[model samples]
Target: RRADVFAMDGDTRWPGGCEGRAGVWAQLRSSGDAIGSARAARWPYEATELEVLGEGDRRVVEHGGFLRAVERFDHRAFGLSVAEAGCMDPQQRLLLEAGYVALHGAGARRSALLGSDAGVFVGIERPDWALRNARQPLGSRPSVFSATADTISVAGGRLSFALGLQGPCVSADTACSSGLVVLHSASYAIRGGECGRALVAAVSLKLLPNATLGALFAGMLSADGRCKTFDARANGYVRSEALSAMVLAETRIGGGRLLAASAVRQDGRSASLTAPNGLAQRSLLRACLAQAGEQRGRAHGVEAHGTGTSLGDPVEMRALAGVLGEATRPVQIGSAKASAGHAEPASGTLGVCKAMLQLSASQWLGNARLRRLNPLVAESVPPGRAGGWCFPLQPGQDALSSAGVSAFGYSGTIAHCILGAGGADAAHERGAGARAAVLVRHSFIWYDDVQPLAQHVEAAEGRTALRSPAAGALLALVRDHAIRGRCVFPAAGYLEMARTASCAADALTAAATLRGVRFLRPLLLDAAEGLWIACEVVAASGRVEITSGRDGAEERALHSACELVGALAPAAVSKPALPRLRAIAGSAVCTAALYAAFREAGLEYGPTYQTLGGAWAGDGGSFSVARLRRPPGTSQGVLIHPADLDGALQLTSLLSPSSGGGGGGGGGG
Candidate 1:
């Protein structure tokens, strides 16, 4: 599962669990052992129980292989207030982070997903943390409503809300099989043409005792602090905490593939509520293979739902052996639970993640904590031949072709997904004609020096320099903030650009401060052409200069210039406080009304430039809330984008003496 992003599990290997998939995989590959231990100190009750019964008496395995600073969320990043963040379920926070990681891994932008037909499907089983927190009294801390912040529906809705996604948002729970079931539903939604893209996540945080105690008393927890999946020592599962997310597009966005997925439900009368039906699982596998357009014998590996239980392990193996026995090669089987423990609703997701890693790695992964296999299942699937870290080399051939991930929930829900390695053909198909989809730039400016903000740094003549193409899309937004019927790129836009450039500087250059910024020429709006912006460090004192002109001119005209600073001297004198500004006693002007008024005055402003609220005085200046009219539920970035800040300046006209009716007039409403 860690290989989904190759993020390292920093908690196990470093100070914080931020190393990502690569780090996590490296640890697993090297140690080849279970990573967690039974906890006595994490919870007071568990500690007291351990103290009374001794350490050996405890059976509950504690897993801390989770993101670092779980409680410390960057509210500013998601545009949430401290109060809102405080009220949010910790699982919600984890899901948000996972969503971001998944999106980034998929090479998709949050801006693109927002307002698009992108659905959110989340699998969540534990609401104990939210319930417990809800019972606490609201003292001096921020108050949280249990119905909104802690609900399971909010888990999926939170993601959709935060990203401005307009597609269907659903939360599903089918006990341990929830994760795979959610994926199943998402795949169908894609097939049914409900959404173009989908975000699927499984988040579980073990913070409350009731949820754990219930499982423990039900004899579902292992007597030892290990998930010995498929081993004769198998007894029960180890509970785990995981927040995993994946972005699913109809077509592959990256190297991974979702060949097919299938979900099935068994009748309740067939067995006990917790019993797993081998017949159902076998049938589910068959259906899955068919959906994948693969034969029963084609898959090279299987990521099993091996929870290390005496009853469940054999049943699952039988299903696998029966369905995949016809394969030319042994269907390599493994369980993520063997290394990371069972993440309940997230178990299926982890299985899929591991399968993707194996397909990409072109090798069969070894089973951890597996020694002697269950006797009943051994005949159909041999212990040694079943699967391991086998690098089978067929003379010159390198890697296996395909693998399948299986998950069977106690709710009698079965889900299976097939994954295939992205071959040269697949890559070629993905990349075919991708250039044609790129935005057509009609500008005369050549894009030779154009670079992304992240890759703009270049050292030349003892100075760090950057060349950026004026993006037409960004300029469209900037063109909206106007003064006197003229479109001028805002100084704030340049400052923002400088700040972004400063991020590429070395540690010695603490910050880049601009001074005496002057705008020599206005960048008029051009439908077919865009300006080219450039920045360079000029002096040793962290002074960075910026200029904008023609794209390909050898010596283009400069539009603006300013000095940059890394640090500023502390001020010795305090500035005098100004009188508080008051809202004008008049009807407020809506953005549309203001724009119409501007049009009548021969000063037309679009959505980006129509920032005026209402005049506060007879002089024509007012300060109103300057908010971007983004799609409903879209989260704002930490710093306001340049276009937004510039748009606010449009309100000054109402207070200026140049206004037709002086400052006292109401907004041309």
Candidate 2:
């Protein structure tokens, strides 16, 4: 299911009618397979067909002139050479960050740190830059073809080198499904016990200045961006460029297993080079389903290749409507081409990247544009079905089927694969299976005039603000991301439940003047950023507690927490009713933790140690044994009671350890 990190595919989900049933039946038959040999041939289109809810007739117009569109993220608004050569630069940059986030989420789940990376695998369609670099460097006049592959190799090299990966590096350009194919190679290599993990990148170059405009004139490009698949108005097709990448881990277990995936070749039955072939698509889908088995999520949501051209859309729909009988059919459907245009060589791989978001997000996000499908035709006539051949697939795993990704190349090459959500048990089947907790919350609080207090707070426990439920939930969200990312995280070992604190203008004034704390508004920081901050000492530990987010009597649990180590503060202040009660003795992480988090950041306090000298930051760590410095004629503040004497002695011990004679005698007049 969508929740399984690495699932198996037995019985699978196809569309309906003759097309769907025939395809599925063919797939339910494969042979003995090594760990993941079945994954090698699965096409991107196969996964796309698995759970196709409905079809979206959106034209590739959405991404037209996308080279200059504004970005959706505010954070990335800051200048960062996100794009590469041209229009493709922004798209590639976006894909890189998304891929990074996916991997980061995976690492967080297992408490897996990106200590050092190994290597990366990528798929490049038009390695023009690589060729360009080679041409610029050596002038590609006659014998410069050798640099073509070398230049493209730089794309994959960049990803691995940037992340500091040191393992093997490889790339694939299997036409349209190049992205999934790249993932296929990477996933298998990992499963075959090669590298620890693989970073898969899919990059395609946009049209060069005259090269593209000239291609359109050559009639190779779609005239009006109208990919009318099955419509009579269908012309040719427009080409788009984009870059996408995925981080796949063999040893790492994510939210769900990849289960059974297969992509069979059409042999010679694909009709024409770029011609639409239902039989070829059906053949590949059948092969995948045969290996996957019939499961509820057989055909969940399909990401169709509907380019809105009348001929293309209907032709693809005909294949779809043939499979799903309309009743128990696709629940949701969409198309990335509509969102980002054709993306050419990176098309197949980029589509798969989007699928990851849908599956991983537990939500079905697809193109809902375009007019409804026309209810007609002999092959599409299912007894009773018209809610919408492809509806918006509801978000969630229950609706996910053995996804099918379909890709057709200009060379008459067709590949299809079934991608299903592996069951949860399949993942826990390995390793210790101890769930790890990763937090992403920054609970900072800014105040003025409490510089010393703030310093003391961060020092003792590394905390800056009080605890809140939102902070707790934020930590949970971070954990969720890791679970769904790569699932390669080791059982969590660090209990980093810390808070963040800052000083505002008002509190800065009070602390500088040494005035006591005054009531003021505490600008609570966003509790979503769980302390990634280091504490000067240990105050954060005492105020906040990091547990498993479970509830019971959290005593021993709190005891083990890195943030609950201080209880002395409250204990010390509790003796107010005792008049001049003098000393304090307590055992708790919170008590002494106060001094630890701050003494280094520099906080002042009356000093008396065990007759030994020691300072937190600059103060010497010492123990004192000395007489009290009382007012001349009045013993107003001095209690002098038996307990008070001992308290005074302990206080003195902080400054001096013992009296000169070693005898414990101290009664002053």
Candidate 3:
């Protein structure tokens, strides 16, 4: 086996922690193979008798091989991963694989899987819980696998559960090509920065009994137990079960890489289940090859389907020959069917695994039954085993193909994956860490019923929303100036400070009751996380006493002295400071409306000390503090700022979290 791609090279093989164990594993696996599958293969291992509970710290296996023991009390030992360990289902297998990667440090299950990022799972779910446990007579379908059969969805959930990723969850129904398509989509997501890493899993479960017989009658199943690709006697396909997984990280490995990929279509131009399209196949091959920089041909080599079907086989060979063109040096080729039968939706994934396996073992395992039929035999399946590929490989070691994954979905979609060597790069751009982005929040809620478009004004680097006004009190002039007229402060009055004072006028009562308002100044909650606010002052001697209202007190009376000055005041008004003093508390009230809008968008706020008369003084009024607390028999111990009580919008007790709900969010007017 070629050990270069994944060998942890003694204390340093994989990107990080996948080493050491690979070494021990390599030795053990070699010994296991040496003993051969002869005796082992005969006694079928039953799931009923054998239980696989993952354990021990030697999870990676030292030098490389199969793990038969449990390390620490990992949730994965229960089945597949931390999420799946509690449940037994087909998804358990995928979870197991995910758990393996995670324990090895190649997994991204914390935030990405469960938080900021999204995920995708591909597979059939295991038998339904109800059906699996029910007594026979009460069961309807006898097997619950039909409805709850696809596990791909659970993969998405498990990944999300482990990683906190939450972008998009999709389960494709592309048949045998589903696994490859899943990988392709995941790669695209990485390139698109939707996620930093993706877990691509493929699996197949035994279908409802007679599903094959039904296919057999439909002519899709080969009556002959064997499958031969590109052979004169080629008939049909043998469906089988297979499971595999490969983690796709956005970063590129240091050594070799899978540069590019292309998927073409046969349109109706190519044959369906019985025929292959050479032209379309070659087009895709060329596209993938073109991505290789200066690489000769489309790939270093190609892996053939070689299902031995008379009609299907030739088209595949012809497709290869067409892609290869006039190159005197023949292209290296082979098949995975030589070992395991075609695994349906997992077929392409299986091929990908074989390609990886070949790169690992440096061996080209030959067809177990076929002698030779194609004229393009420049070298055998193995070049080093029977001493290299001069003829068909006897066994052992040889190079097969650097690229060899192709699949045709019944949906008329065909895809090819280019195999690659491995290593990790720290420089790769990934959208996985902390990201602070601005989201458009409030659009106007119009009384005219017009759709108010949302204006998402982003922070243009170094942008800060300053707290322009926090306290203010409106006074003596017109009670309804805003309804028909606009008011201006006196020449000596600081307009901005007046506005702040006015907004602050209503706050004193609430702040006093709550033992003083403590604004989490400079609140930097993200737009996605929701609304932000802060504070500036404590109005001095502010009292909500009514002095002139004839009825019960609705109009608060902190402006008593100003009113007294006004009444006595033709003379007092002549005083240098009387007009400005009278305007100070009255004007601070006008800032309320403007400040309300800022409260809706999540942002940081800083005090805008805009008083003109002097620096730092409380609202010049006679307000006495009144403490407010949640009344008895109430669960919400909230201190609602009386000034903003009318604008508060409370949410239901329970809410389903959603991003569209706005990250910087809290209900408000």
Top TM-score hit: 1
Report the lDDT of model 2 for residue 452: 15
- Candidate 3 lDDT by residue in tens digits, 132-208: 33312111233334333234465456545544457655566576567677767766776677765555666554422
How well does model 3 score by local distance difference test? Answer: 0.38
lDDT of 1 by residue, 458-521 (tens): 6765577766555533454366555567665666666656665554454333234567766666
The sequence of per-residue lDDT tens digits that candidate 2 reaches over residues 1-669 is 212124211111111110111232232111100111101211121121122222221121111322212132222322323222122222333334444544553452212423444446666665443323321211112332333223555556544544455667776565666655565566566666666666666655442322344444445445555333323444555555454444555443554346356453543654555566765655665665665666633667666655544444555666666664453654455565543456555666545544544554345653423344433322354556753444442223445544556565554555545455554433443223533222232212111111111222222223344222323322322222121122111111112222122221112211111112121211122332332212222332233332222223343222122323322233344333221221231211121443333233332122221111221111231322223333332211111212223223234323222323212222110
Global CA lDDT computed for model 2: 0.38
Clashes of each: 24, 181, 128
Residue 528, candidate 2: alpha-carbon lDDT: 26
Each candidate's TM vs. the true structure?
0.57, 0.44, 0.46
Error of 1 at 121 (Å): 0.7
The predicted structure with the larger TM-score, 1 or 2, is 1
Quick one: ranking by TM-score, best first?
A: 1, 3, 2
Say which prediction, candidate 1 or candidate 3, comes out ahead on lDDT: 1
